[model samples]
Target: MPVYRPSEGCIHIDALSCLRNTGITIYNSAEPRRDSLEVSVRTSRPSCQLIERIESILYSVFQVCWLEPEQTAGKVKPFFYTQGQAVLNRSFFPCADTPSVKITYSATIKVPHGLVAVMSASQWHEPSADGEFRFTMDKPIPSYLIALAIGDLESAEIGPRCDILIMPPSFPFGGMENPCLTFVTPCLLAGDHSLVDVLIHEISHSWFGNLVTNADWGEFWLNEGFTMYAQRRITTMIFGHAYMCLEAATGRALLRQHIDTTGEEHPLNKLRVKIEPGVDPDDTYNETPYEKGFCFVSYLAHLVGDQKRFDDFLKAYVEKFKFQSVVAEDMLNFYLGYFPELKQQDVANKPGLEFEHWLNVPGWPRFLPDLSPGDELMKPANDLANLWSSPEVDLEKVKQIDISLWKTYQTVYFLDRLLEKSPLPSGNMVLLEKTYPKVSKTKNSELRLRWTQIIGKQKYTLPIYRALWASSETARKLALSTFQDTKKQLHINVQNYVSKILM
Candidate 1:
C-alpha cells in the first residue's frame, strides 16, 4: 500500500480493492516524500473493493477432532486462526503495516452465541452474555502484533498474570504470542508439562517486544533476541540453571547448523541486516534473530564478568525505551552509556569484543554463551554413548547405568549424542527402549523428537511408523521431519498407511 498522510477527515469505503467513484485531492507537503490527501463524497453510499493477494488477512474455518471420528462421532468443530503480518493488516483495515508506526487500539467484536473471541489486548476471559467481547491495549504496538481469533476456546492459568488459550487439537504452531491470551497447540496438553517452555517464551514477549519495540523490520532481532534471552532466564527460574543451559546449548547448535546451511556470509545470518527494496520481510525470517541475538546479549553479560550487572543493564534499557521503538545502534549506545568504561580504548581493543563487527558481521561470533554448565551434566550421557558404540561393552552393564538420576534434557543429550555416532546394534537398541521406558512413553515433545529420530535412522520401522501416526496431527516441525525420514525406510504398505494418515 502507498504511504500517505490522512487529513482530519473520514472517507466511507464500499470496497477496498477497486475505486469506483472514489476521488481524493492530494495536498503535497513541502517536505520531500511527505504528502497529505483529502477526500469527500456526498453520495448516500461510498465504497472501495477488497484488495486480493496471494496472502492477506485470512478468515477461514478448521475442523477439530477430524482424525478421531469414532470418539467424536464424526462431528466437526470449527475454529479460526488469523495471521496478520507484514502488510496483511492493511487488508483488514486502513493503516500503515510497517513497524515504524505504533498505535493504541480498542475493539468490540460480536461472535456466535457459543463461541468466544480474543485479541492482542487487555482481555476479559469471559465474553458478555450476548457474545460481545471488548478489548483495549494501553501500550502502543506495531500493527503486525495486532491479532484476533474466534472459536470455541478455553483458558487455563499458568502464571500470576499469564493464561494459556487452548485451541482445537488440530491447530498448527506450538503457540502464538497474542498479548493477554497466548494460543497454544493442543499437543502441549500431553500432560508432561515439558512444552510449557513455549508459554514462557511468549510471556517474555510482554517486556522484550511489546514494551520495548523494534524500529523497523531490519532490526527485528531487538524484539526476538531480547525475548529469547528473557525466556531462558524465566526457564532458569522455573526449572533450574542446568535446564536453562541445556536449552541454550540446543539453540546454539541450531544456530551453528543454520549458519552452515545458509553460508557464513549470508546477510540473513547477520544480527543487523539490510532488507533490499521489494524483498518481503518474512522471507528473511529464521532463527538467527532469536538465537544469534540471544548469543550476543549473553556474550555481553559474560564479558562484563557479572550476570547481575547485565540484568540491571537490561532493566535500565527497558525502562528508558518502554513504549518506544529503537534500532540496533540505539541498544549499543545504551550499553555504552550504562557502562562508559566499555567504550574505552583498552576495553574496545579486546579481541572479539568489538560492537560494530559483532552487530554487522554475518555468521557466528567469536564467543558463545558458556555451555559448560550443561556440558558437565552431559558428560555421563556422552560416556554412555561411547560405551554403546564400542564392541566390547556388555549390553547388560549398559542397562545398569542409573539413568533415573538424569533429567529429561540429560537423557535427550545422551540420545542425541548416540545418534551422532555409529548406529547402535539391534540388541542395544532394544535394550535402550526397555531401559528408559519413560523416554518412549514421555509426553515431552523435545525428548520424543530426538528419540524418534534415532528410531527412524536405525530403520526401526514399526515404532517409527507408530510414532508418526500417533503424532502426525500435532504438526510439529521435528515430527514432520521424522515422518519423512521414516517413510523412506518403511515397507510399501506402512508407507501407504502413513501417507493416508498424514493426508
Candidate 2:
C-alpha cells in the first residue's frame, strides 16, 4: 500500500481540498513543520458481510484473494494474487490515493514455507529457508504501482532478465505492469500465443507509466494514453504499420463503445477528468484515457510531421521527465518548446483544434489519425463482417476465406466488427456457429469475450452473462465496472436482464 517511505512525507493538496470542500473542518490551513501535518480521516463502518469477510478472507483492497490450488508448472498448490490497477492500492493503507505522490520502498514479505512472494520492485530476491522474501525499488513509484503476489508459483524465462507470470483466469486486469514482475490474465494464453501484445503493453509501461507517471488521476491519459502510443510504436516495429493500425482500429471501436455507454458528456469521459470531493479515483477509470488519449498523442506526432524527428522528440521527452510525475501542461509546454517552429505557428491554439479543447472537452476525438493504413489488415475483417451482415448470405464465398489462416488479432478484429453490426439475423447467427466451430468453443478469452457480447446483444442468454462473472470479489468488482461502462450500449431488455444478474 502507501506507507511512508522516509523520514519525511508530503501531504498532497487534493486530499486537503477534498476534506475542506466536503464539509470537514480543517484546523490548520498554513504549512506545518516537517514533522507535523496532522490529518484525520472519516472511516466508514464495514457492513456485516464485509466485516465477516475481513476477518476470514484475504480480500484486502490490495485485492489479495483467498488462495486456491492450481496445476501450474506441473504441480498443484495454493496461489493468490494482488491486482492494484488504477488506485486500488489506496484502500489497503492510508495515502493521498492519487497518482501524483511517489514513494521509494523496500519490502520484506513473509509467506508459508512452500509459497513464493513477489512485489513491484527493481530487484527481487528469493525467500530465505525461513520464508522471508526481500525486495527493493530504488526508483520512486506511485502507490498504485505497489503490488504483491504470493503462491506456489513457477516461472519460465521469456527474455533476458525477464520471466512471464501467468495469472489465473480470475485476475482482475488484462495485465499489471508491476516493475520486476508483470501480472497477466491467463486468458491471454490463447493456444496460438497471439495475445503476446498484452505483454508488450505492460512492458511499454516500464517507460511511459512506471517511469513518467501522471500527476493526478485527472491526467491519467498521460499514463495510459502515452503507453498506448508507445505500445503501437513497438508493435509497428514488430508487426508492420498495417497491423499496428489494425490494433488502433480495435482501440477506436472501444472508444466508441465507451462514449456510447457513458454518453459524450459523462464526467469521466473528459480527457482531464474532474475527481469530485472524496471521490474514488478508481471510479474515473475508462477508455477516455487509453484510447482517446492515444488520439491526442497521435495528433501530436502528426504535428511534428517527421517520424524520425518525432521519435527523437519522444526519446528526449522521456529522458527529460523520467522518474517524475507530471501534468498535461508539463508535457505540452515541453513539446512546444522542443519544436519552436510549431510554437511559432501557434499550433497549440489552432482554432477548434486547440490543445485546451483536447484536454478539457469530452466526446469523440477531433483529430483522427490516418487509420487508412489499417485498411490493408482491416479490409478482410470488414468484408467478412459486411458479408455476414447482408440479408442474403453466400456460404461458399465466405468459405473461400479461411478463418484459421488469420492471426489472433484478425479474428478478434473480425469478431469485434460483427459486434458493431450486432443483432445479426438468427439464421446467420446459427450459421456462424456451424461454419466457424472454433468461434463457438474456442478457449481464447479475447475471442470468447467478444463472442459472448455478440450473443448477449442477440439472445440475452443467462449463460453468456454468467461467463463474464469471475468468482473472486475483486474480479466481480472489475466485471461490474466493465458492465457499467458498456451497459448503455445494450438493448433496454438486455440491460435490465444483466442488471438483475449483477445485483
Candidate 3:
C-alpha cells in the first residue's frame, strides 16, 4: 500500500489517480473473517485517465480484501457489520467520497443464515432465508455514514418520535435510529433511562450528520460536535434539565481528557489527523471532535441564553442543508447569520481553538501550561496549561484551600482545573481523602457528586464507597437522580467505587 498524500492542485484528479493505483488494504480488525473487504465500484468518472487514478487511491487504502461472512466457531470473525458506506467503498463504487458530493446509496448484502444486517437509513426489506438482504438509504450520506452489522441479534421495536430498535445482545455503541429499524446495544436492557437518551442522540443525527454533512474531515466538529449537542438536547427533552446537566458533566470530563492529553494551548477548533512524512488527510480519530466540539457548542448555547432561539438556529441549519454538504465556515457563517451578536465576539478570545491548533498545524502544537501565575482568574488556567508541560508540578496549594470553600461555591470547575494539572501532589491526595467525608454532611448535591467523581477515580477509596453505600437509600437515589438530571455527569469512577461497596 502506498502512502496517501493529497497533492496541491486538482484534488479529484489526484484522488482518482491514487484510487486506481492503490486498490484496497485490509488487516485483521480484531475479527479475522470480517477483516478483508474490497469493492471495485463503478462511478461517474469522466475518463479512463480518471478511472486509473481512482483505482490507485483505493488500492493504497484497501490493499487486502476478504469476502468471508460468518463468525466461525473458535475464531473471532468481524463480529458486526456497519458496512453501509463501507460497502460502497469495497463492493459497489467509491461514492459520496466527500460530503461535497452527496449520493443516494442502495446496497445488496449476501450473508449466511441467522445473521442480521442493518444500515444508517431505514430497512428496505425483510430478512429472507436465501441469505440476502437489500437496504436502500434514501437519505444521501457520506461514505462514512453507512453502517452494516451482522450478529446473533434480536431486535425490540417501539415507537416514540421514531421506531426504537434494540439488539440487546451486542454492546455496540449506538444503534440505527431509522424510521423502521433502530439498532441498539445490549446495555439498554439495563432498563435505565439512558437507553432512550442514546436513541434520541442517534436519531437527531439523521438531521445533523446524515443530512447536512461535513465536506472535509478537517471540519468533523461540524458533524460530531453538532450531533453531540443535539443528543444532549434530546436527552433534556425526554428526561428534563437534569439530564442536560448530566450530559454536560459527562462531556466536560471527556473534554478534560482531550485537553489534558493535548494541553490548554490547543483550541478545540484545531483538531486534525496526524500524518506521516507523506500521508493524505491522515485518518486518525480523536475525542476532540466528540468532546471539545460538544464543550464549545455548549459554551455557545450558554452565550445564546434562550433555548427557543438556539433551537431555531439548529432548525434553520437543518432546513438550509437538508440534503447537502456543509463546511465549518458555513456553520460559523450560519451562527453569525442568526445571532449577529456572535459576529462581535473577539475571535482571539473565543474558546474554540482545539481544531485550530491541531488540525491546521503541521505538528503537535506546544501546549505548555504557564502555571507561573499573574492574576487569580488566570492562575488556574496557567496551572492547567503547565501540568502537561512539566508533569511533576506540586498541587498542594490548590488542594489545601478549604474543601468547604470549594464545596460552598460548588467549585467543580476549580477542582477540574486542578485535576487537569495531572499527576497532582501527594499532599493534595491526602487532603482530598481527609475532606471526602465532609461532603456527606453538606446539602450541596453538586459538591458531593463532584467529590464522588474525583475520589472515585483515585485509589478507588473503599471508605468513601462504603460511606455512600451505608447512607440512606433515599440519599443514593437522590444523588443518582440529580446526577442524571443536569449537565453534572456523575463520575463513572463512582460506579466502580460503588460496585466495590456492594461486593
Candidate with the greatest TM-score versus the true structure: 2
Better of 1 and 3 by TM-score: 1
Sorted on lDDT, highest at the top, how do the candidates line up? 2, 1, 3
The numbered model that scores best in lDDT is 2
| Per-candidate local distance difference test | 0.67, 0.75, 0.51
Q: Give the TM-score of candidate 3.
A: 0.53
- Report the backbone clash tally of model 3: 69
TM-score-better candidate, 1 vs 2: 2
Where is the poorest 10-residue window by lDDT in model 1? 28-37
Candidate 3: regions farther than 4 A off? 1-80, 83-93, 127-131, 160-183, 265-284, 340-503
Candidate 3 RMSD to the correct structure? 14.1
Ordered list by TM-score, greatest first: 2, 1, 3
Residue-pair clashes per prediction, in order, are: 11, 0, 69
lDDT per residue (tens digit) for residues 116-201 in model 1? 67787874545688998888887788776787777665555556777567655434356767677677766677675666777888
Q: Clashes in candidate 1: how many?
A: 11
